[model samples]
Target chain A: MTERKREILASSQSVLKEKGYAATSVRDIAKALEMEPASLYSHFKNKEDILKITCFDMADKFELAVREVNDIYFNAEEKLRLAIKLHVEILTQNLDSAIIFIRDWRNLTGTALEQFLTKRNAYEKGFREIVQTGIDEGVFNETDKKFAALTILSSVNWIVEWYKVDGKLNAEQIADKLSNFILSGLKKEMI
Target chain B: MTERKREILASSQSVLKEKGYAATSVRDIAKALEMEPASLYSHFKNKEDILKITCFDMADKFELAVREVNDIYFNAEEKLRLAIKLHVEILTQNLDSAIIFIRDWRNLTGTALEQFLTKRNAYEKGFREIVQTGIDEGVFNETDKKFAALTILSSVNWIVEWYKVDGKLNAEQIADKLSNFILSGLKKEMI
Candidate 1:
């Protein structure tokens, strides 16, 4: 992408983060970029198109983070911890992208919508597979894998809503707490 | 409230739900109610006042639901389940109010913001007390009580994002599943 294109996407993301997706308009983006409304047309088709791109880009980054974390760990417990850390780190660093992913993915329609749903489900399935691995290897409890996945994902996803820029809690602290809580729930104890 | 005042608030809520709080202007509410903008001033000082009333109404209903549920349950487990059930039921039934509570609470300034925060935090504290009681009674495992409270709240709170009007899972079903998962985490092993 050209510098201008990146700038437009970045500005659009900031606007979306501050005002949300539905409130954002082409005129708003153009005003933020200090360009005529038509200038945005050259880079992206419309507001919907920009949201679609942002959602897709966020999905890609999330998937890449999962893959990178998986490569670094072989144990199921360590993999789970690292995956949560990677997700929280990436999300905290690029909060705009995370907000777009959570808030605007539903705004997408037609083929763009389909593409996002597909990628999102695949990403969720990746997490589910890891949980299943932990369960089968006796590292995690034998529970409903899908529900566990959803519960974990929900907790992680809502972090973007409450994460503070200047707060004392870092991504690693959150990751450690989350991973510990989840593992404790899954670990078998002596009767 | 007078009949006209009630109608105005209801219309404001509907408009705010369809078009978020940030985007819903005073004119939009006036148009939705088929009244002149000047007439709305008789009921509300401005858009922020409408939001303040709406948020207060939402917080009241939420607290009522929690209190009603807590009154009927003697055990921590049952109280927790009832609390989750009522929270979801109230939210799903009045998605508009829920949306306003979730999204526009921050738009409130000054005394209104402080009042809403106080009520919201107090409401949350009710749940935290229930969790702490469970831990003291040896029904729940040792964990950060406040953190667990937030984790459970976040998991239940995000249901509004994925829940559907015609989806296979109704509000009751979703609430049941969530309550069950949360209870499972808190329940002591019988072995």
Candidate 2:
């Protein structure tokens, strides 16, 4: 995408986050970009198209961030912490896109929705594998791997719903707090 | 609510869950109950009113379920375990209402929105205090109480999203799985 198109999506995210996808129209996205509706249409077909791109962009970011856990040193614990930190940063730093990513995802249609779900399931699998591997290495407790993964993902994914840019905890602070809380649960200790 | 009114609301929940708040109309709700739209409007001013009631009914159920944890003996760990179990039961048992509770919450307006948030915060406080007490009792690990509460709540509150009625794990099974996983995280042991 060109710099101008990226600017348009960013502006559209602001409107979508505030008014929501159900209420937002193509004209609204164009208005936010200060471009004529025809010009915006030239760049994208419609509001849903812009939303699809915006949601998928965040998905790609999530896929990229979670994959970075592979690069961390051999400690599953450290890898888990870094994964949480980077994931939280991606959402917090791109706050508007993050909000749109959750709220407008339901509005995606047909192949767009399927594509989103496919990427999402793949992203979740990547995240779950980290937890699964932790358990396999005996670094984490012997618990239901899928449930543990769901709990970890749910706790972090939920932050997108309530996180504020100027909230009490910064992204790094929340990341540490959450990772500690989750890692504590997963660590295998001698009885 | 009258028996007939309660029945109408229950029927509305099904339509709302399928079509969502924006798309599900008074006609859709009325048709689900085999009533005329005019009669449905008598019971509910519009789709939003039915939505408000649906969301709050689930909220009330959640509040009642959490309050039951207090009735158990004062083992903080037991209380926390039972809390997760009961919370999960309320959500999964009233599965449709729980779905609407999360998805359609944003559609609530004015006094209904304020009332819902007020009840929700109080309900969260109820759940948090259990974690807070567990931490003080040393049954749970020393962690940021609020962070602990959020993580605990996130793990259980999230059950509403993915739980399937026909899924392999029954309510009791999920409860045991989640509570065990969470309690393990909070148990104080040698590092």
Candidate 3:
């Protein structure tokens, strides 16, 4: 919550992304932050602890985005499009945390790992609920909801791998385009 | 590739998927194959070498699948759909190699790594050409070809992460569902 803690978490995410969770150390985070390893210890107990905080922070962000979308009184089709836009915004906006969250969350062990998976499944379930709503209302195609949800999430999750600071499309445009692409797949009737 | 060489590659890919590229050692692969480390070395100089072959072998599978689809003279939409099915079939049918190909390809280095990137670009280009053909023929939406291609590829690629042999959808059903989702994104209009 503090300014310095945010910096440490940000640096940890970056170092974890660059060196990978297995290869990264608190010292690497300290080096990237230009701080003492002891200072990092004061903030986080260990590398796994650092990863735990980072991973949970990412989960919180994803959940928060989903919650924000839920506040809007829109149809399932509009809700999914807006929720996807929010999800992609977080990923492209905070690129480092996005990459580390997707790639290195596996490195978290014990309760941290278990909780992360639980939260992730819940987050994906939110998407699935939307797809089910669409299917029930006949706004979207009546196909396998799990398959549809996974397809949408996978396509968006992959943006972190290919997104660039100066790509052909900005984050908003890319989100719009991606939302269009995904929504087309779910639309009841093709245009 | 010789029978024994193919066996080595197959075991290497499975071990790499299980233990990851960093943790899996030559001894691990040898243990998996019930072969001595020296015998493994006669096939691959080291773990990285084994990884190189496995990655390229997966790439070859991808290229071979695309080639088979190219033999058909369907419209771009149908061509792209069949190509996606073949691609997913290769991934789900050869599950371990598909996971390794997506996850562990980052661990490759040197000329093998460079050549792999080149080949990957060419493989993507193959897909792009199909999309372009569809766009030219007025069968597909005139969107950013790269973004559309990347969307289709990413959705299919992530299947290696969630697809199961005994899951709700069989390989053929999954391939069909995914192809339908993706083609819906590209088609000019509903039939």
Candidate 4:
């Protein structure tokens, strides 16, 4: 992305996080960027175009983080822990992007909506593979991989709903706790 | 509540859900009820008053549903399952109320916000008890009860963020799948 486009996306994110999707408008985005509405259209066709770009950017960042974690080729247990930690870390750092992804991504219209959904599903596929690897390696118990993925994703993805960047518990702590809880359940422990 | 007060609260909900709390005014409520704005003030002190009443009404109904589950005195496992089901059921049956609670409850000011938080915490107390009971009975492994409660609540609360009454998964199915996954994690079993 060009520096100007990046600046517009960041400002759009600031507005979206504070005012929310339905309440935000192209004029609001322009106001935040200190540009005329028509000027914004030059960098992005419209507000929806800006939103789609923002969503895709966030998704790409998340995917890259997960890929970096995957590159370690650690044991399934370690890989899962790192994956969880990286997920939380990126989300905590880019809370504005996370908020926009969680709240406003669904509002993308027509082709934009489909493209966002595709990227989201691709993002989820990484998590599914982690769970599958764990089970396949005999480190995790056998279960319905699809449901397992959904359950774990449900917990992790919803972090943005209540997670506070300045909360007492930091992202690493939460990731550790969540990883322990999930791993405990997945292992064949006789607790 | 008096009949007129109840009517006012009901009308306020529809308008709030449709137009949002920021946009919906007393005049909008009056229009919905086909009465003068002056008549609404007789039942509600102001717009915030109506919002408080509506939120409390939603919390009260949710509490009732949860309390009914508690009265059954199921084992902690069963209680946890029933609690999840009841929460989903209420969120589904009362989508408008749920939306109001999710979106507009923050508009509550001063004492109303405190009261709503107290009532909302009371609603969560049931789940905390279920988790504690499971731990005490050795059905669920002892983890951080508070964190576990928050995790479970976070997952369930986000359901409203995505659930559609007419969606592919009905409330019961979503409840069952979610409850099963959570309980699976909590229960002393292999995943």
Candidate 5:
């Protein structure tokens, strides 16, 4: 992408984060960029086009984060901790796009919506498998793996809603604290 | 509220859940109720008024749930479990209002927004107190109490996004499993 195109996408994400996908218009994105609405058309097709790119880009980052963890040699407990840290880091680093990815993807239509959901489910499935591996290996508790995975993801995914760049804790500190809390829950009692 | 007013609020919540607070119009709420837009004026002053009621009503349910849990004589662990169950039940039962509560509150303006946020923070504070009590009593682990509370609440709150009325687990079962996971994380190791 050109510098101008990247600037437009970033501006669109900021507007979408505040006004949401359903309420945001091409004009609003242009206004955020201080450009004419017609100018946006030269860079992108329309509002949904921008949303699609923003959502997919954020999703790609999450996918890559998990894939990198899976490539490493670690126990499920360590893998889960690293995954949580990477997930939280991605969310905090790209706060605006992360918010759009979580809240506004439902506004995508047709093939775009279908494909987004597919990628999302697969991403969740990947997380679930980590929990399953832990349970199978007797590292984590013998709880419902699906529920455990969803609960863990929900706990971390919600960081986007409340994380502050200027908050007392930076992303790494927040991640460290959160991972400690979550790992305690998933790990079986030590003998 | 009269039967008609109740119907209007319910319809408003449904429409708000779908179109969101920023995009939803009075006419949309009216259309959802199969009534004329002017008729809605008799019940709600405007779209924001409807949103305020929906948000506060949901917030009241949450507040009341925590209060009830606090009133009981159970230990902190059991109290947290029951609180989780009650919260999950409220969200699953009033899915539309809960969705509006979670996703659309940012659109509330002025005093309504301030009041809503106050209630929200207080509600979180109440949950945090439960964890604080646990730690004080040497029950929960000596982790960061605030992070523990936020993690537990976020884990439960995200239920509104994925919970299906006809999903495999009922609200009670979900609460049971989730409370186990959460409490396990919070509780210190038993000798």
Candidate 6:
């Protein structure tokens, strides 16, 4: 995307995060950018178009992050630690887009919604597999892998809701502390 | 509240969950109940009134649950277990109100919003105190009490997003598995 289009997407994300998807309009995006609504129309088809792009972009980031960790030669424990760090970094650095991705994706309709859910489920499946690998390798305890993945993801995904740029703990600190807390539950008992 | 008023509140919560606070109208709630908007006006001054009540009522449920747990003689570990079960039960049993309480509370304005957040913070603080008690008793590991509390709350609270009434796990099952996972993380190293 061009610099101007990137700017529009950023502003649109901010407005969507504030007013929410159903209530936000193209005009609201335009107003946030101090541009004409017609100008925004020329750049993007409509509000849903912007939302689709935003949600898909976030999904792509998560997919890429996990794929990178998967390609590495780390064990399940290390892979999960890196995954948690990457997830927290993406959410904290892209707060507006993260919030919209989490809260406003329900607003997408038609093929967009279907595809979004598919991508999301696939992403979750990838995360669950990591937990499964840990159990298979006799590193993590044997438990419900689906429940474990969801527990880990939900714990980290929720950081977008309460993360502050100026908070006491930065993204790395949160990722470290949270990873320890979650991994403690998943790891096998020490003899 | 009268039976009629209670019915209105229930229907209003469903509408709010579907269309969101910004997009929902008083007419929508009336239509959901097959009543006229004029009739809704008799019970609710406006849409915000219904929202305020829904949010506060959910808060009251949580406060009561924690207060009951706090009044009991259970140790910190058992107290935390009961708290998790009660929290999950409230969310699953009252899914609509839980969703509205978690997501739509942001739409509240002025004094209502302030009071809602204050109550919410207090609730979080109470949860943290339980973790602190465990740490004080050396039952839980020495870690950031605030972070540990938020992690536990976030894991369970996110259940509202994916909980299925007919899903594989019932509320009690989820509460059991989630409590086990979270407590494992919080508990100190067992010799």
Best by lDDT: 6
Q: How accurate is candidate 2 locally (lDDT)?
A: 0.82
lDDT of every model, 2 decimals: 0.80, 0.82, 0.83, 0.78, 0.86, 0.89
What lDDT tens digits, residue by residue, belong to model 6 across residues B1-191?
A: 99989988998898889867877887788888998988988888777898899999999899889878877978899999999999999999999999999888888889999999988888888798888889889999998777788889999998988898889999989999999899888898878
Error in Å for residue A113 of model 6: 0.7
**Model 1: reference contacts kept, as a fraction:** 0.32
Candidate 4 chain A lDDT trough over 10 residues, lowest sum: A182-191
List the candidate 4 regions with Cα displacement exceeding 4 Å: A2-8, A26-44, A67-74, A139-142, B1-58, B69-75, B92-119, B133-144, B158-176, B187-191
Better of 2 and 4 by TM-score: 2
The DockQ scores of all candidates, in the order shown, are 0.32, 0.55, 0.54, 0.26, 0.70, 0.71
Off by over 4 Å in 2: A25-39, A71-73, B30-39, B71-73
Clashes in model 6: which pairs? none
User: Which tens-of-lDDT digit does each residue in B25-117 have in candidate 1?
Assistant: 788888998889888899888888889888998899878877776667568887888889888887888777787788767678899999999
Q: Which is better, 2 or 5, measured by DockQ?
A: 5
TM-score of chain B of each: 0.90, 0.91, 0.90, 0.84, 0.95, 0.95
Give the docking tier of candidate 6: medium
Error of model 5, residue A4, in angstroms: 1.0
Superior by TM-score: candidate 2 or candidate 5: 5
TM-score of each: 0.76, 0.91, 0.91, 0.72, 0.95, 0.96
Candidate 1 at B80: error in angstroms?
2.8
> Tens digit of lDDT per residue, candidate 1, span A71-141?
66577777787788888888888888898788667678799889888888877787887788787778777
Quality of candidate 2 docking, DockQ: 0.55
After TM-score superposition, the amount by which residue B102's alpha carbon in candidate 2 deviates from its true location, in angstroms, is 1.4
Candidate 3: deviation at residue A152, Å? 0.3
Tens-digit lDDT track of model 3 for B65-129: 77666677888978887888889888888899888788778777778889999888878888888
What is the per-residue lDDT of model 3 for residues A1-191, given as tens digits with 9 covering 90 to 100?
Answer: 78988888887887778757765666787888898888887777777887787778888999888876766778997899888888988888888888878877877778888999999998988888888878887889888788788889999999888898888778788788888998887787833
Q: Pick the candidate with the highest DockQ.
A: 6
Residue A32, candidate 4: Cα error in Å is: 5.3
Clashing residue pairs for model 1: none
Stretches of candidate 3 exceeding 4 Å from the true structure: A23-30, A34-39, B25-39
Worst 10 contiguous positions by lDDT, candidate 5 chain A = A143-152
Residues B45-107, candidate 2: write the lDDT tens digits: 776788888888888988887777776667888888788888888888888888889777877
Angstrom error of the Cα, residue B124, model 4: value is: 2.8
